[model samples]
Target: MDDLRTIIDKTLKQYLNAKQTPFKDNQLANYFRREPKQYIESYIKKTGFHFNYDVKSSVGNGRWAIIPWIVLFDTDISNSATNGIYIAYLFAEDMSKVYLSLMQGWTYYYNEFGTKIGQIKINAALNYWRNSLNLTSSTFSTQDIHLIDPSKRYDTSLPRGYELGNIMSIKYDAGQLPTNQKMEDDLSLMIQSLEELKSKLISTKDIDLSNKYVLSRTNIIKNHKRTPTKRDYDQQS
Candidate 1:
């Protein structure tokens, strides 16, 4: 990702300096997504892992996104931030650091089970994944990642969902990124880690993955008032 450091660094500087929201015509903002996305594509291609990537700086067509991101996904697992689990590079709104995270999709649970139950589901999945993935072998963090200020409330809670949904991640300073060798190694491990989740998912019969795949299915997660029993997370499904 050394090649990516230039794009990531310059774009953050430009975004921090922008007097207005970034738009389609904003050459620098657009390049942030357009240019780096190609490097991501080639990088993943080298791993021989089948993944689709999206490098985004803004949402809709009019404004800069609160948090710009690049996601690598398997179509069967997820195609967007709306549902399922995927790996992504998330930029903090304050422009301090970027995180490469194996995170969950919160919207699917909210739409299916409502906010309360949705959160429960997310926690259960987090427990299951954290235990199953055994992230100790990697350099990624198992701690919480902050994307935006916790005090401010937004019209959309997507950013909050991101904060709560992170399972494991690695932080990269915006000003100082890792070398090419370090980045390449991280990518390989990330891809392998995601596959471990996929293997567990294959055992589950019900998953509202993306909007397209699990159109009519419903996922009813285990509900617990306190610490769950061993059986609560014994089955990944």
Candidate 2:
């Protein structure tokens, strides 16, 4: 029964003592991969909640990457939705804070540079969830979540993309770590909100159509309007 605070503490510890860079750190990489799985499985068992969820962890690029991330997708809606939305739990390096985000989908924009271009679609989805759950008091932060289109910057290497539908993030200072009780309370709130959002999404009749239109619009721009990169061709092949 690993608590959420324990998970955050361990991540901080690993980040501080990490000898290897973000990409090459096998120890840190394994922590993100293993911890999320254990925590999610244990949470499901303990809470007696039947959630069809999928867990994924990644140590992006390997060289300069410091933050390893794990995502938990309520596959019930993710698999069926247009944007392939999911909940992401990211451990950042600067503040050693945890960022909770509702990710719309995985796509990149490369008009000049590259970015995630689905603000309208993602906003619609956000409104749908927020309104359905009556999350009027729930505040969403784009502090850690990059809301601007990165393509405007024209920096090819600037890592951007991952449309954040809604984000609720927390930061821990240099010496301050969240207490177990605090982390549990935060996690509880997040989980409850997600559960309600998932239920509403699954039960909604026009959800499929809405998602379809969003996906189609995105594809029209990415596939037809934008020039295909070598990676795209390779993927098609």
Candidate 3:
């Protein structure tokens, strides 16, 4: 059995490397970057928002490969607040499948001595850490979770999925370091899903973003209206 580090390295390489047989000459390769941090920074530059990788594999944990990251859509996020949102890819037990999740932080605080306050005070301003509420497509359908509803309170419990937050996701099943069409298709799905999620997040932040895809569902809907029936055409004539 391969360790988590080796498996992840191989999986990502097969999924993105141009020299690899399956992904060669594929447009999907353009979206993937071998260096995850640089890739993330490139994405941030392209979209003009803060995106940072929050988790990665450690030498001790051989069975798990989980990489979670935050998208700082709310630039005004309080420095001391342990509250934010995240998106991540979590490897399954056997490392054959990955679960993509979007989550929100539920934070906790403690009381500490504050000379400025002259006494021990609950440091609500100082973030301790956060436990997330799963907000991915696993909790809601794809159509439902793309954009944030301005009127809906995400922190409240009205809608099932929105009770935590909105999210988008796609599963990537690259079997035992697969290097074939299955891997290609999976990567495509993952990339497209990430792009959609990023676009929606930017839009939710009220920032105007132009989607890179020239021919998307939105464009199709805008360019092609429903055709009227022959009877309607005759009547108009």
Candidate 4:
């Protein structure tokens, strides 16, 4: 737990010290992608719970350029390899919103050079999620179709829209319970805080640091020279 706190503190500090550049958003996205598995693992450890979660991403143009979706399930008690508790589903309009909410202290760093590096990271993450879910569909459906009546195979009364191209999915095993709970709680809190901060930023139209909350504590190591102490699985059990 102490190590997890230290890692988060260090990450947050790096985020704060990072210069606010046009492409900082892209940088931030890359930062998370580089250590995604580790980050998620730490989150699980801290939460002291396990769960299964899926994430997906797709790209387009304008506001619809990037989309990310996530679904979470609780770990199954009977089978560690399969089954989980149903958690929540999340859908983000773009990578920026996804990062701002899920990854604290790492937003707007990848918006550099009018490039879509952040979008690429999102797609990669989505791919990871899809692989985890073992989805058979090579291409996702672009239309939203539903039948009004369960007895009828098709419904004529409902309005049908083409499936939006960007979509992804994931599944979790029961063995991942503790860590999953921690991640979910942390992510949920971060999202709520980010929403409030975003609303304030929009209202004030300010980009100054003074206006933002000090979400991270200072004192980050200048040199990335620390070795993480490994936990003993046998001892833990």
Candidate 5:
């Protein structure tokens, strides 16, 4: 895992430098630099110094995008007969970024734990953690959950083959964090709309009906029918 993380971090640095858009805020960058100070503080408080953390940068978008950092902790605390926090980080630039980062994080965890027992344990833990963070969602379909599991075939191990079912069966509560899946979905829609607009602009040689509603409502003098208004041309300009 450490080797994989190092390779990813190196790739990210090269990608960012190639784009010439390093993050603007050094402090924010450092907040995600390795085991973040904030996460360390929280872990210390929760488990009373028995736990330690390992941090790594996972993914990043272009200059205007958010980056994710993963944090894995060793905990002496036990929940459901398993030992320690075993937490993973999905730190990002905002709520929307956090949502995508978490999806990526779950993908990584699922890949790492490929066995039935491992899958059962990790799925339950993930559901509990999300709920504890107040990150439960009605929007997460079974298809979405299946996407995260590398072994697409479901057995008795994963319960209803969704996070909520795993958590409910285990009877564990984590609490709420924050949810931004809706915002992420909305942003995706906006990007798609923009791409469509751009395609239309490229394909059309003339602007004919731009602001047609307003032009149709305007009164024209004389008995002749009005010509198409100049606003169409102006829109092209």
Candidate 6:
């Protein structure tokens, strides 16, 4: 309920203050997957779409990552980051910057086509989606992101794959994050394009809306208020 700007600034500081030792058992690392992540969910709940999300300080197991991330997925499209298109907030290895990117599930393409050909398919999907969407934000970049550090060797290809998956993105630097109003406005703008894309998928593929298997944030709001109209009830079922 506090201002989102305040929360984001605080979270960024927290990340920086503890960046050097983001072990799995570290409390600061755990905070990324817990409270801050929930706050982000609460803020974005105004969008009305349901999303699945996760934050990682490590590649997996005990392997700490240089580029940590928080990601949100619209299951109506795909449930996991490994196999579908989704949105993510990627933090730089040095904590100097973060990127809000519309990215694809690269491992899926990599598995199906090998890295060489998978990259080609990823580019194809990127072009198709960018050309089809109605996004009006000129601020978003489709070019590149600064997630992988060139100086350090990485054990996993996740970071490189993430870089290759970028379809569009907006960058925010440390100490230069916009005001709460601006941040919310930007998120809402991106969500509009995402929602429209979702609608297109449903209509074109004849995908049943009921197959989404998730609760809309609007429904969550109604349920929390303990007041729901008959129409709302009907929609839920």
Best by lDDT: 1
Worst 10 residues of 2 by lDDT: 228-237
- Candidate models: Cα lDDT each: 0.68, 0.52, 0.31, 0.28, 0.31, 0.63
Put down candidate 5 lDDT per residue, 180-205, tens digits, no spaces: 33332432332232233323331222
Q: For candidate 4, lDDT tens digit of each residue in 126-206?
A: 233233342233222212212122344433211111111122212221222235345455554433332333333312222
lDDT, candidate 1, 1-237, per-residue tens:
436667667656776666274475776666665766677777777768764444333433467778777777766566777667888778788889888888888876676667776676776667667877753455878788999988888877878888878888888887688876787688678878887777766433345432212221234444534332232222333
TM-score of each prediction: 0.79, 0.63, 0.30, 0.22, 0.27, 0.74
Candidate ranking (TM-score, best to worst): 1, 6, 2, 3, 5, 4
Superpose all Cα atoms of candidate 3 onto the true structure and report the RMSD in Å to 1 decimal. Answer: 19.6
Task: Note the residue pairs that clash in candidate 3.
Answer: none
Ten-residue segment with the worst summed lDDT in candidate 1? 209-218
What candidate 3 gets wrong by more than 4 Å, as runs, is 1-34, 47-83, 106-168, 176-237
Best-to-worst order by lDDT is: 1, 6, 2, 5, 3, 4
**Index of the highest-TM-score prediction:** 1
lDDT comparison, 1 vs 5, better candidate:
1
Look at candidate 1 and give me any clashing residue pairs: none
Ranking 2 against 6 by TM-score, winner:
6
Total clashes in model 4, counting residue pairs 3 or more apart in sequence or in different chains: 33
Q: Considering summed lDDT, which 10 consecutive residues are worst modelled in model 3?
A: 122-131
